[model samples]
Target: MKRLRLYFALFFILLAVPIVILLSHTYSNLEQESFFLYRRTAESLMATVYQRLQENLLVEEQRPYTHYRYIHVADRAVPQQEGLNLSPLADFPVQSKIPGILGYFQIDPDGSFHSPLLPDKDPAIAVPQREERQEMKDKLATLLEGLFSLTPGLQAQLDELKLEESPPTAKKNSSNFRDNLESRVDITLEQRYEREASESTYRLGSKEDPKTDSLQRRVQKSSLRQAEIFDSQLKDAYSQDLEKAKESAAPQRADDAPDSRVVAGQTNRAFQMGDELRSQDKDVLSEPEAEPEVVAEVDPFQSEVIDNRWLVFYRKVWPQQRRYIQGFAASLPEFLESHLDAAFLNSALPETASYLVFHQGELLEPTPAGQNNPRPLLLHSAALPYPLNDFDLAITVAQLPQSPAHQLVTFLALFLSVLFLGGFLGVYRLTVKQMELAQKKSDFVSAVSHELKTPLTAIRMYGEVLMEGWVEEEKKEGYYQQIHDESVRLSRLIQNVLTLAELERSEWQINLTTVQPVEFVAQITERLSNQVKRAGFEFETVSEGEVKPIQVDTDALTQILINLIDNAIKFSKDAETKKIVLTASQLGNDCYIRVRDFGPGIPSRKLKSIFEKFYRIDNEMTRTTRGTGIGLSLVKMLADAMGAHVDVANRQPGTEFSLRF
Candidate 1:
């Protein structure tokens, strides 16, 4: 049994380790999946905002340079000199389309400031001069001043710009532009145009965020987001015609300076600028005029945050060999409310999640929701794509949402664990019981062999001595008597063994008959008195009250009484008062027969187990009692077979075995 228990413990430990690991691994996967799903949703929403900004920027990049000034046509004919010279600063539709646009400004390389709200430069044009335009300019100046006051670093940069002959980024941007133009010189006009258009579109370069990269890879593999596919095949004929057109139509530049008249003529052909400004301005040049040669190139917009509270986006356009900075500034609060807040509100992210905006590494305000929480859990962080590369975005959640299968997996793990533990416990207990029963059977066999050998040896020796005629007449009678007693004892032992075997095989049947208590007691005493006397135990039978009749099998009940009396005689033989009492009593509709011995009583805890087959309180090899351990077990089985119940109890000086019906 001990060895079996050790094996069960080892097995349980080995199995439990993997079970625990499996459950833990499952839980970890569920947690990771939940976080991954949340982060993907947040990133998708951010990408939507990015795409919107990119589209807007693309539109701004495509703005015609001539749109900044007004032109006049004379006599409904083309003449470069007939156009009006208006201020390049004029209100445009881009101000209304973009959110939180304070105003647009163009800064000359010579440090001259110009606003779109400024009136026409040429006074010959009869256009109304509104006071609000001046107010708008003043407002823009105040906005810049307030923003510069808060941002010392940007203010210093602006002061440096005033001292420098050219902006710090001009050389690199100019070199890139020149390289692009030179590379396209050999291409066909149509092919060059197509390639230029493609190059003008910004690439959202890969950002270094381990989590986002991992999630993006997973998202792509899952095909959760579909990507656009474009055709790569080109027309060879179109390319040949475009190449001829580029060489024939291309004009030469004079003195390394571009003529705005020629550029405007080229631009007007596409945009119809002369028609737009003809009715508004009348001071137009009558003929072509000579102006100093100039070169021009425009760079993409760049964005920055000032004092974590303002966003400024600007672009550099070079014309006439001089750089011009054109851009707008807006307050961060309005920007967030217009772009970030709107996107967040429309996003599918959970309510517990928060979107945080950061300038450089510093956090920006209008504080995001849940930012002030005691411990905000961060889910994903990523840098915005250019022109907003200076900013970063972080998503946090007060509490992450659980995975859809979390509950199911948890319950399944728990149920499996419980089932496994229960099975192990049940099997272990059953194994213990079986092992104990095997040991008991072994002891029973050894005890039975000893018991049979003792009596059989005595009977055989006595018969052999008598048949040899070696004893005198009187002594021979004594020897013969010994043989008779030993034979009877051996016969009774054999009968009990056979009865137990029959009961074990479930082949025993009972014939229950109604019998009076007095008659039953008389029958029991007559059958068991001689056996008890022979064993030197005084036997007595008593009836109490008006003992009621009981429904019992008479032969079975007699056998039960004989086993009990025999047990009492064997157990009480060593007592000072060796007495066995058979008592019959009536209580309401029940009749009880109790056989009690005045000897050492059974221990309270062991009393119930005394009826178990082959169970002995004393060690089998060390016991002095002359009886098998199955007597009480047989008694209980007979009682139960007869529709009666049997139990044992400790008496004042001994133990009582009760049979109730």
Candidate 2:
């Protein structure tokens, strides 16, 4: 039984091992799958957000990029702010929320624009930019050597204007002006005739200001008029001088002109052939450098994110229907809340999931789980969705909280483990009980055989002596008495065995009758007194009150007392003064008979189990009492069949047995 319990315990533990592993495996898989699903949902949501941003930006598609592109420097007293604001991109609709935007700037067709964002900038930074821009222009001039033929005539044109405008003197002033033109960086023509108040006189005088210098204002106004005339004359004279120079310098045949120099412009009138530039650069080519190729129309409504953070877009605000490139810069976070967040708020995704975006090596907004944790997983990464700003971008989402049903499954798995342990314990206990009973039954058989043999041998010996006439009459009486006592004891053992067998097979019958308690006590004492006296135990009987007649079975009642007395005698062998008491009493409607012995009492732990069939108080391996284990069992079975209850209890230096009717 012990070994079986151990095996069962080990089995259950082994069983739990795989279950725990399975549950853990299942949970890990679910977590991974959930992370995958969240990744997909985040992708869908980001796509929608980007789409909405594009749509919102489209509202200003046709409205021209005039507001984003102007770069005017303050000259004299007035700050010329034609279009450029200090924070030029601050006014763009989608980009307005961001604080860091360099202005929209375009380099001349042959150079690169690398201007920084404008506000009040430090001179140290501006100086570097100026130097870099100058380098870029110099590099561009080298690459477009054929285009230099158009540039050389401009400095000469400015020198001729100052010469023609001066009195037939001031030749040194004209020479200084030509030297300054050569030093100037930007060479684009600015039409002074197109200024807002062109061809107009000054209007500074008012009637209320009677002392104002009207003559002084008139002189200033006349100076401005003369300047405007000078600008107009410069434009017309430069065109004529350029044509005359080309006509005089060129050979008669187109092939005869210097190959290193080509008059670069939109039309072939400046150069006979236009093959110096690559085909891809044609869209950007325009007057003064290269010819403009016919370009396919692009949707002006298009807009896109730049380098994962900036916004690159365009506006066709150029006058005379000329094409140009324009853009704006913005903070990515501000843009998300202002435009993208609403789109995501309306997307269909699990509420337990949250998201973060990472581009290149930088984490944009939201964030990964923590500093120590990478995004749970990765696969669905979307790059910036426009050709203009090609950025490597990705979003990682975490699905953190588990569902209620998932929690329930985990609970059930643990509960099942406990149940398995409980069941193993219960089964082990029952097996132990069975084994104990089996051992007790084997001990009972051996004890019963020993008891029967002792008496049977004595009877056989006395009968043989009497039959052989081996003793005189005086000794014969003692031998016959010994033989008779042995017979009687052997008969009692046989009768008890037969009775127990009958009870076990459900064949025992009860003849119940109304019997007085006094009579019942006398009947039990008469049957047990001889055996008690023979065992050298002091026996006594007592009854309380004039007992009423109680339902009783005389034969079964005698058997119960006889077995109790016999068991007491067997166990009380070591007592100094062996004593047995048979008491009868009446209380309420029941009569009680108690047979007690003064001897070592039954163990308190085993007291309740003392009456089990084939069960003995003596240890099975070292039983010394001369009786089968069934005597008390018979007592209990007969008493139960006769409408009575039997009980046993431990007492000081003794054990007590009782039957109630």
Candidate 3:
């Protein structure tokens, strides 16, 4: 049993040790593989966003770039023209090549700066002058007679409507809307031209008289103020024309009935509808739905969007036609959504996944769910580089194939645990059985050797005494009888051993015969009475239950009883009142034979192991009785071959060994 246990321990150790190591390595590789994939995704995503963002920035901002170089246009100071007091004109090749440089100016010997684009004017920022006020007024009259019209589309549409196209030819006639718009625009320009003529009259008067400097200054100031007022008036007239056109095209029910002779009214209305459609601006620019809340305080360098005002850019050194540097004051949320929302929505991620982008301290996220979702368990993030280096984006994901490495590692660990455990249990059972068989075989060899030698030594000793004639004639017969008895004992011991060997090999069989129980017991007791008395053990044969005839193999039954009686005598030899009983009875269809003894009882724990081959009760020390351990073992084998069941129990004073056949 101990050897069997050791085999089991060894098998389990073999099965488990290697599997643990294999799983450890598998998990390590899984982690490395997962990390590699994550890093790979992050690196490629950053690179792609970097390239795209750089392009967007350059295309949108059109930033100023500068380069410096020392250009010597001349090796020596050039002589100035003695007659010319004005500065050199702006015709520099270098200035044209440089970005945003409007023009160049050089200081003349008279300390006056000049550029070709800014050539001399009589008075700066003043309107052009005309001498013939009457002739100009006549040209205006020619223009008003229809030489030109700025609002061609509105005028044509209003002509088809025939609602109010012009002022009436008669006092009672309805007005014409087209004529009214034209007169208003033309009259404003004519009025400004009239003011220009008046200013020119003052300049002409000042030029004729050399000492009218004061009068010239006053005239220039008055002309400048009048010019500003005229510009305002012209702008207002144009705006009014635009507003009138829009109002006329607004959706409303026509006042004139279709059949009431309304100047082919349907066709005219259709043409006007087409005109209105063609006049609308096609470029659709988005505006914020709601204005951003105003703060109590303002921050410098951070401006808000303004209505109807554009942030325009112009050449750096231009003639003040536009501002040099200006930023488009955009509503942050609306602008970003218009540009970036669709891109993220149509990306490789699933519809359920979320994408969030934060740039320049502002955040943009898609709301496909109509509301923002909570942060999910799995998320991948990457930072943008170059133009968008301060920006980052994250994707909250749900379907990532089980985190590739995590799935692999978990599967491997589960598979290995089951495989190793099954292997350990299977191999352990086989190994344990093998070990038990080997242990029993070794004990059998030692026991057989001891038993065979015991009877042979005694038989040879008495025979030699008779051969040597070492005894008187009176004792010679006793010696001869002793030799015969010893010979019989040796023969029976050899027969039992051979029978047990044949039984183990499955080569032994029994032939049963019907015999009277009383006769059966008497025949067996007659043979074993003298032999047991010589060993100082009293023996008896008894019957129980119904004394019916029993099926018995005569010779095998005799051997079976011999072994059982012998085992009882051997174990009970040291008892205070040594005795053995062989019992035979018929109960139902089976025969019961019991061999009982009055001796020290068997221990409860060792009872089951007593019938095993080469097993004995006196396992701790050699016994005083002369016997091998195979006596009871042979009895058990013979009983089983005869289709009998053997059982044992602790008797009141000793032990009970019984068989049911």
Pairwise lDDT winner, candidates 2 and 3? 2
Specify the highest-lDDT model's number. Answer: 1
Model 3 stretches with alpha carbons more than 4 Å out: 1-379, 383-453, 460-481, 515-519, 547-552, 585-590, 619-623
As for candidate 1, its clashing pairs are: 81-285, 82-284, 82-285, 83-285, 257-294, 258-294
> After TM-score superposition, what is the CA distance of residue 585 in candidate 2 from its true location, in Å?
4.1
lDDT of 1 by residue, 631-650 (tens): 88888888879878998888
lDDT of 3 by residue, 1-661 (tens): 7776786678677867887787777765554454335334433443354444445443332321111001111112233311111112212222331222222322211222222222222111111121232233343233322312223234234324332222111011113322422332222322334444344322111132222122111101112212222122223333433344344433333332122122123222322343355559765458634323211110111122123121111112111111111121223344434334544444544444454554433443443532344433223444443223334454444333336567767887788788877877777777766665566566556666766676678778888888898878899888877887878878887887788778889888778998887778888888778888888988788888787776767777778778777877777888887888888887888777788899887899998887776666664246466565677777777877777788888888988887777
- Residue-wise lDDT of candidate 2 within 597-648, one digit each (tens)? 8888887889877788888777766877777888888888898898799998
Model 2, stretches more than 4 Å misplaced? 1-64, 67-352, 355-436, 470-478, 544-552, 585-592, 639-644
Worst 10 contiguous positions by lDDT, candidate 1: 224-233
Greater-TM-score candidate between 1 and 2: 1
lDDT, model 2: 0.52
Candidate closest to the true structure, highest TM-score: 1
Query: What is each predicted model's overall lDDT from 0 to 1?
Result: 0.62, 0.52, 0.48
TM-score of each: 0.62, 0.53, 0.46
Alpha-carbon shift of residue 343 in model 3 (angstroms): 13
